[model samples]
Target: MAPMSLQDLVASLPTGETWGPAASEEKTLNGVPYAPFSKGDKLGRMADWTAEGRDKERGGRQQYTRNYRDQIYGAGTQTGFEIQQTEENTFSLVDNTRTTKTRGFGRGGGTVFRGRGQRGAQTQRGGRGTFQRVGGRGGQQGYDSRGGRGGGRGGRRFGWKDYDKPQRNRDASVVAKPDWKLLEEIDFARLMKLNLETSEGEDIDNYGFLYYYDRTFDKQPGAPTSQRKLNIIERAAYNVTTSDDPVIQELAEKDEATIFATDNILSMLMCAPRSVYSWDLVINRQGNKIYIDKRDGSNLDMVTVNENAAEAPMETTESTKDAINSPQALMMEATRINYMFPNQTVVESETSKREMQNPHPFYNPAEESDPPASKSYKYRRFDLSLEKDDEPLHLIVRTELDAVVKNNINGDDQYLTIKALNEFDNKAQGSGGALDWRTKLASQRGAVVATEMKNNSCKLARWTVQSILANADLMKLGFVSRTNPKSPDSHVILGVLGYKPREFAAQMNLNLANGWGIVRTIADICLQKPEGKYVLVKDPNKPVLRLYEVPQSTFEEDGEDMSVARTGDDDDE
Candidate 1:
């Protein structure tokens, strides 16, 4: 061959020839498809120096990163080219080094103490101390930075190790026998999302009489002039359950409504999502009617104190040293206060009392020693039917009014529902970070009420719901405090505050439609099943409601047993 210039060599080459291999029509080479890659992709290194020893140090986390990195370079399409290792080709390396057993807590050889102090401290016995951190710096004094004893002054007090606190396993109001079958379990989250619009409901009938509310208690709270010693009033008051009431039974016979409930039980169900304590209601479904009733000496009858608090009053079994602040004791004290408050706060004069449509249905003057308390029971019916329903769903609730007050704007008689909130000891362990009511109740009245709303959310919500259900013009909340923090027997009325029922509901963010939805949903559940006795129980620890299809003799035996006990006690006396 003869030597040629660069231009002559280029001209002598083939027209479509190039310096690289010839372009092929087939997209595969050696039966392997070409892996599509972007022009902006960076070439990966065959061996990564920085990645060495990192996989072992990071417990093989680097392998995940390597796989992810490979995916960025179109490794997904190159799977066919990957080598398949067989059992023969794979070899395992076994270490001959002897492993020594170590004594330690958890993973490391150091004990872990959780709290606000030195994480791993040594005990006096030369062993690691896993004692929970007490409070304050260096765990010196029994104080915590987050409002424990002698710390975080003026700040809200939080329970120590709330997460580690023992679960409050409260006993249900009625025991579920082995024969009772669980029908449904609904969570509060689901209940909260349900909503149904309902009407204000019609007044079916009215019973009992109410006295005029004495306006003297409405003076400024915590004032020496306004404070009055809560007197023990002898009055015959009745809390007849739905099925026990003769009027309700008569209405049920007349087919007035599909559901029957009292204000107390209905309020509890409507505000179930706000409740923290364990409560149960008896659901007796007969033919086409559902009656919501409570047992005698039920917790539902008694008002709860701080039942919705983050750290509610504990039982003696829950390591609560203070018996006066226990849940049972507080409930008794609150119930007593609620029972005596309305009677004493009203002017019980025949001339000033407001008569209802009928006289007291359950009271008999010849059989009772004391007169009837100032109360009025109004039977109201609400429509819970949706647009798609064939038949209208109605609920009749026996609502109550404590007293009748004359409106200031118009002299018309305004119905009132009075409820008292009792205070035990603000400085007690489970006081729910309450302020000193005697001091703050006057100057910081809003703060006191706000704190109460936070602590007693369920109780207050129930009261509000009851007030609304009764169509009361005003809701009176009396603040009653113990004469001695150490003694719950003696209490003095601090003051009384008045709020419109609807306005109060608005303040609490309580939606009547949502409550109606919950009630309707529960009613529909029972209506779907056959005629049987059902028990609706609020879960103690969890925000859940469970419906149990109990036997016919479930609560009947309980009542009989209680009656026998009472008779025996009376005979012994």
Candidate 2:
């Protein structure tokens, strides 16, 4: 066959043929079925893929006869060389023999192999910069430049261990023995004799006052029981007069003591003022008018309690006579006591419009004092009772103390000072004001309330019975209602008030203990309910406190299933 040159091969190929052999159905130039390019294709139409076919023949097949030796030797040249595997190619053998001779070396010099073996080639690990060498066949060894082994030279594989272990907590269960026995262990009779008093001459103990009453009043022959009741009433008045607790101070300032209990139980009650007074009520019967005094200024006829009672006796209305005679009627007068000063109240409608734009009068306390505790501490008692029970179970009677000493004092200023001290939890710095001065303002307010209570004590006492029976909780707490044969619904609980503790003991009535029990039951329900810890409902905007004393049974029944739900076997895990 003639030698085919590159030009001859190109000229003999089909024009339309692709780089690879055409599809199985494609036609060849000389009647062959499989061709490198399609029949009708033009030259230079092949893509980069066609360039790869240059290494093969026109038919998309390699020249099998053209081996490396044949190509190197070419057609006529003959080179005698046989391809054979050498000993190095057959296997990698372990050589135990090692050379020990040195060739002009100092630090690089060594005593040769420690063991008789050829060391494997040292391989440098990428990025680690550390080298490791295989000993003979399987033996391997490496060392860190910093005299450490393993992970990467001197580096360590750091990790958190036992991070999931539970933490230890301090035990808070240590009971210490007291140096002296508790007060409960001592006979209350002997302890009552201690009669401790502060250096300032104020009684430091509640029992001290009781002790004084017992020694001086009770021991006296034919002393009226009224004398003992007077002492308790005085102590309560004292608390209103001097207590830092706002509730007590408010009662003193307002001259009122709220009776929070019913006739059935007279041992305990949360008492305070019926309403805080912003202005003093001064009735000018001579002028036939009632005047409201803001202390700084006064207004005439703020209310028409009586139109012409002062002008003519026959002109006085029945309502006017009733209002003049009652303390509750006086309390009702408090409703119109405006916080606005005399100047603000006098502002004309046109002037008020301009003032409203500025609003300085409203915001400035000096110009406008806060309305006398608008929702009276009296309102709080009702709210508390209503929240816990469907209706008020007891009467918050407005009462006055008997023969209380009146000392001139500013109730508001004193209350403010007391409040500041309480906020910082501080005691009075020096001698407190004289008891006379301390109690004077409260006494005046208290007297008004007391006079009202005194006139209506009989009627109020009856109302108290109805109130006690109405309260289911008070009834459950052993406050029994006795029915009267004459009045269908009316009843009486004897000795609810005015009975002395000594009288109870001497008569063996045990009434004092029963009274004490009622108090304890109330305290427990208020403080120890399991549903949550005890907390006072406080609204800073409202100065009054709403308090309730729930019965123990009531609180437990509220969460009756709690104890049962908490029961089960302990889990060691």
Candidate 3:
């Protein structure tokens, strides 16, 4: 065949062709089923994939006679190479030969629980909780490219290894897991409370029990216990002056937990703030009105709760109470808190959005502004940077912290800066804020999300959940799975992206290469077996090879089976 133009070559192109070398640079051609061109992914030359380059045509229809001896067919011919490396540089990844070392989750060697070890030291009993560990290696600052926050062995961080391009090797992908609280994994009741109560049911006003004589909590709430879990509440904020009656003032300042538990009305008067909230009932100081802040140029409201109420933790809410009395209000606030908790009852609340954490969007700070922490320890948080995908997809990456390193100078200031999210569990005790933040993150299609500056860097870890969960295809293809209950599996979240993968994910395992799959060893790929065995779904052109890596199971220990199916044990040879 004569030398063909790019257009002619693409025109003659067979289906399932991987356009490349210069294809990504071409942007778009007349009409071709071309893969989304990414300069990062390796793409070989288009011409080399043709029958003109090799003998026997590589297994009938299989492309890429990737063999080097066929660089030129016969003599006096031009070199046909798919991958072009200019005089500049090229990157390649080399894997560790020790395949036996790769085990799933806890049983895997050389893998360490990077955040958990740090938490044990900070706590009273010297630490037994793995989820509570904070910070990464290299001082308390894990973000620094240097030492202290990474590498259990104290060398450079070890990640996907590379050959040739040293710069690309240094470009390590740090996959941080979500900081899953030890609380209820699925929150089945809460899920029912929101969906059935709000989405499918009538707007049942004032359904939850109103406490007139309940008591507030005293000890810290770490995990979910029948008696220990915090309750979400709707309350009224009040302002009492020098001329006011003692009865109202006492009730206004009292803690919800104290009033509900002990019913000691005089000692602890729990005021009812007609605000939509969860966890703590925010008591806005009397005379406080709706006001706007310059941030984001959006109308914002602060509780302006009495400095005395600062003794009790208060959260902020973004739910608006306007026109709840009107039918249009129902349509306007469909997906947000309005679905369940609507209307901040106070009439003035219509002017501004109520400020308190509840159901979906909630935030309970480690320490209140002017008040000391209710407990002895200071607040800790994490900061991270995520690679922005073109679209939101379900994604989950779990890396056990090698060990946690912590330093608490005083009760007011504590530092636990580390890798991943679970470590931030103890300090960031607001599951409400986490759920809200996750929703916000999922809204951003493709954005590199990072937490604000704080000692601990990986608080909530909800963004990680959003990343993997939204990308249903990737998650179903065995790319991500939850390491904890808060992350049970991608099933529910993937449903958000309109995907169901219960069957496919269950069928294949990376441990067995008999079926069609992708890069088995980061090396060879088998498109189709000669005898016509199994094929990969949605990827008819590409072969799916089995991977031999099986994660270690906590199932037997948890009284649950591996659930991961065993491959038929087909031999590659």
In model 3, where do residues sit more than 4 Å from their true spots? 1-97, 101-107, 110-199, 204-573
Highest TM-score, which number? 1
Candidate 3, residue 309: the lDDT equals 12
Regions of model 2 farther than 4 Å from truth: 1-237, 241-266, 270-501, 504-510, 529-573
lDDT per residue for candidate 2 within 1-573, as digits (tens), equals: 989998898889999665776467666667776657564443332234433453463223342223222332233222233223367766553422222344322222232222212212212101011112112222232222222332432222111121252322211111112221211111112211222111111111111000100112213222223121110010111112112234333433453322222211221111101111111111111111111111111111122111111111111135544422122232223112211111111112332121111122112345444421111011112112224444332212211111111123532210000000000001111111111211221335334223323222222222222222222111000001113222212221111122222332333212223322332333334323333211121111121222222222321233442232211101100
Candidate 1: C-alpha lDDT: 0.77
Q: Estimate the lDDT of model 3.
A: 0.20
**Backbone clash count, each prediction separately:** 2, 14, 74
For residue 227, what is the lDDT in candidate 2?
A: 21
**Per-residue C-alpha lDDT of model 3 across residues 114-167, encoded as one tens digit per residue:** 331132222111111111333333433122232123444432222223123132
For every model shown, what is its TM-score relative to the native structure?
0.74, 0.16, 0.16
Candidate 2 has what TM-score?
A: 0.16
The true-versus-predicted C-alpha distance at residue 538 of model 3, in Å, is 47
Model 1 alpha-carbon miss at residue 556, Å: 1.5
Per-residue lDDT of model 1, residues 1-573, tens digit only: 898999998999999777877666667878776877779685555566645564675348554364355454444322223344458746653322122333433222222233333212222101111123233222233332322234344221122453365655665455566787998988776888889988888998999999999988888888888998999998999989999999999999999999999999999888887777778888999999999998665678778888756456776654554477887778878988999999988998999889999999899999999988998999999999888999998999999999998878879999999999888998887787788888888999998998898788788989999999999989999999999999988998999999998998888788888888899999999999999898888766666788999878765656664563233123212
Error of 1 at 135 (Å): 14
TM-score of 3: 0.16
Task: Give the better candidate number (1 or 2) by TM-score.
Answer: 1
